[model samples]
Target: MVASCATCQQKAQQVKAMQTNIDFWPTTLKLKNSSDLICDESLRYLAGKRLVCRGRWQQRTVAVKLFFHPKSAKRHWLREKQGVESLISNQLSTPSLLFAGTLIDGTPVLIFDYLSSAKTALDVWKELDNDEARLDLLQQIVVEISAQHRCGLWQQDLHLGNFLISDNQIYTIDGDGIKSSTDGKELTTKKRRNNLALLLAQLSPNYDHLATPAIEHYAATSQKNMRDLKSITEKELPHIRTTRRHKYVKKAYRNCSEFIRHNSLRQVAIYRRDADAGLIKQFLNNPDQLITDGTILKNGNSATVAQVTIAGDSLAIKRYNIKGIWHILKRCWRPTRAWISWGNAHRLTISGIDTPQPIAILEKRLGPLRTSSYYLCVHENTPSATDYF
Candidate 1:
């Protein structure tokens, strides 16, 4: 028993040490918002509980990303900062990390040297008029990925949006998903092939024609057998797609946030602190009124959806309605659908996949048992899946 106690104490100390190390940042380049700093009037990108803004520091333009989700802020910030540092140490092409630290409110912030002329490979691919040009670009990207593998690193979230084209060179961005092997060995043939296959799978299904030549070029440049590369990629592609879909379905049923629970004679409500307080108040104050008056997008026996404008910003609100007393009793112990959808959306965005930005979730219960729930999210005006096809 004494030995076990000592072991437990040592493990506690190790965890404490790790947390202290993660919270530490060099003070040499710490920034303060003052006359010297100026930010652009509008945001450059906003998704996944984070926002990117253009700003000037020391007269040089920079991109500032603020990660606002408490649950993921520390992990994402550390992964991105460490990944950039690792790539730089290995002499790979990536954005220069200008500064990294936390804001006064404890939000993690990272500043990077801005590339004004850079365009995401997704945008460039959409503009290419011929297959030859597209194939050439794909070959260049494969070469870049090969270089990373040579350095014993691989980006788990390999997607077109993560590749940036500038000055005829392909540069990588969004380093949070990059990983390295734990055994200190060089990347093996299997690992390299899997990485290539994952990258190809992220492209639109319509680009299936480019897979053959792209794999052949990669195998040639990397000095691997073309047939081996083709065989591995063909087997891995379907598995990766199936895994992605399965992950989404699994995560959609889990609660993803710690919500403030409130109960009263009339209803029960739960919300997050980061969410807009005014909106939550309006929602809980009269959920029935909002459901009846808000513009309904869909209405079914199980649920209802509406497009609600609160504080001048449009939001998509989904309300799960109980069909009968039996339904309420069956679901009272399970997580609300609103909570599930919110978690799934956030997970998709953080994985470098596209989804609507989730705002908040509220549940109204009978006594301690949840009977109705509402999920609120930013109403994206982008093209639907059918439109893209």
Candidate 2:
């Protein structure tokens, strides 16, 4: 027994030393393009605001996520690394982090063991034709959540996309979404129910029939009474919907590629789709010209809306007209109308409500006070609420 204990201690020390080595490993791999990758068989599998490539590393298949934004890359990489390390220490099932480092241009790169045959819960749900299979999957997800709860960890952003299934085993991904209790106590009743509700919210309204059985299974696995669980879930349903609505909206805003520029001339805010400074300046300088050349949608007292196609993309530009000198003074202390509307549009969109996608908000200010503002958004052909009424 003494020899075995000594061996374990020696192994632990070796592991600690190895980790320290890896943490300071020089990060010499500067990934400029996919061509620079060592693995020739690598294919560009996923491309979003960032890039995800599936390739072989160290004789094993791996997934590499490369961040485009330096700041975001550093922040998310650190959070995910911390979460994965915590899960590993607790002996929880998750992907093994093979490597994490920054490239020459300071872009963060994270490599993890790839589950080649795995499918996200969202993907499986679309393929599932029968209700039984769907229910089974939900049960599996609940069991996994219960296990995590028992470990005093809860995923703050629970959704179908975060859960992956392979070989009949469900594995949780998106380590940045995972949260743990610091007090070494079990999750509170409210926290557990909220987490469960978040999972349920991802399902379609038609799948309401599966809620009862799923909840029952979760309660049984968590060793909680079905009646009490049902009561808490019932009371929390409305609040859950509201919370999820806002959460999704915030997520949408974060996902958008946007930037703000300030100079001696004017303040400009631009989104990914409207990075053309010339086009934005044209709309800001010549609103009247656009009204005459472009399609006028609305001519209101306080605002004028026009649809203009710039570079083959249709956009709606709303010019907030200063009603008079009195109106300008009243709004001087507040943010520009364009800024307010841009934020409100995002709020409406994420709340499961319908609204045009806000692309950009530009304000031409004279010193500290605002002089003119313009809100640009994607042109949606949907009818107004008043028309239906």
Candidate 3:
């Protein structure tokens, strides 16, 4: 509605075009974020008003988010929204907060900094060619997420898409899960249960046969990944070796080891940048917060725009590149894709569709375009295990 430059005007016009006749095409067909498009709930909110999907208020490249439905006032939505804004405002390397306001429909709209080099969980697993890199990514995720928990924010949902891996450190993206409480252990247990329920709900009458022992194994391994956050204040993470009584635990460890052997990131060395060190250090010393990876499903695209596949019941990989300001800018230009992909995966997983157990996400900066990448993986898919890396 307001503008001062040519870039602003271009963005405005594009948003206008996207909404005009959105129903004319297939939902599967993707479009540029601009161009006046109506998408999901945002489209419902714009039913009467002719609002455009303009870029963020301060940055020309950031995405514009509008909320038409507001969570209960007593709920944590408002509080978390404020918290996220404050965190990002301090120049924290987390996702940039561009805008937050309530639409006429009462839904809370949130705009965020877009990282172009960012890749989703689906992207990484689909592109992953080996297991070593996958295992390496998983290990880094465990360390980084453990560090986040120490920062006083419990990322309720540790799914893969919630973070971006670049420069050997994980940068959190979604903040809905960030909380004020220091209940890392409790939150981890709840999230694990939530994920399990979601999986079971989507399985068939032969759930056991369909999910296989590997599914339970993956769950136990994921559970162990959160063990480091038990106290959140120890000098170092405690060792969590598999024990006999913990059948699921043993299965989980075996599954993780196998998955890492096939789909890991290889000998790719992680390169950390000086600029990101400050943000990384903030959570490193905290004792109450914990961060976890988003679940990588079987969809999404990559930076090179390469087509990826998690065919069969094997783990997959998806990757992206993030570095300077320009790269982050590119991510803002298109914000709906990740949200959309995430929605689809959640729906499929909840609707009894055969999906994989998303374990870890790998975010790191290597070297050139070929070296920089992101990775997310799953355990198995259907009846048979083809590439269950």
Q: Return the TM-score for candidate 1, rounded to 2 decimals.
A: 0.61
Candidate-wise lDDT, in order: 0.72, 0.70, 0.38
Residues 1-389 of candidate 2: C-alpha lDDT, one tens digit per residue: 78755543453343234223435222223454432333323223221224455666666777776554422556777877777776677677787888877554445677888898988888998899999999998999999888888888888778888888888878888787778899856687778888888888766656768988999999999998777679644667657867777765454334332433433345545343435666767765675676667898889998899999888878898888898889988886678888678768866754546677776666776666776688888898877779988
Specify the highest-lDDT model's number: 1
Which stretches of model 3 miss by more than 4 angstroms?
A: 1-59, 70-80, 83-92, 102-107, 166-169, 182-389
| TM-score comparison, 1 vs 3, better candidate | 1
TM-score of each candidate structure, all chains considered together = 0.61, 0.67, 0.37
Candidate 2 C-alpha error for residue 28, in Å: 8.5
Candidate 3 local lDDT, 264-329, one digit each (tens): 333221111211333223222220121112233433334322212222224333444445567655
For candidate 1, lDDT tens digit of each residue in 1-389? Answer: 78755543453343233223434221122344422334453234232345566767778988777665535657888998988887888888998998788654345778889889989998998899998999998999998888888788899888888888889988888888878778645588888878887887776556778988998888888887776778755688767766765765454443332335555754545455456778888887776677677798889998899888878888888888889989988998787888677767755663557676776667776666777888877888677779977
Q: Once superposed on the true structure, which residue ranges of model 1 sit more than 4 Å away at CA?
A: 1-37, 41-52, 65-82, 98-110, 123-136, 180-186, 204-206, 249-287, 294-323, 334-363, 373-389
Clashes of 2: 0
Superposed on all Cα atoms, model 2 deviates from the true structure by an RMSD in Å of: 10.6
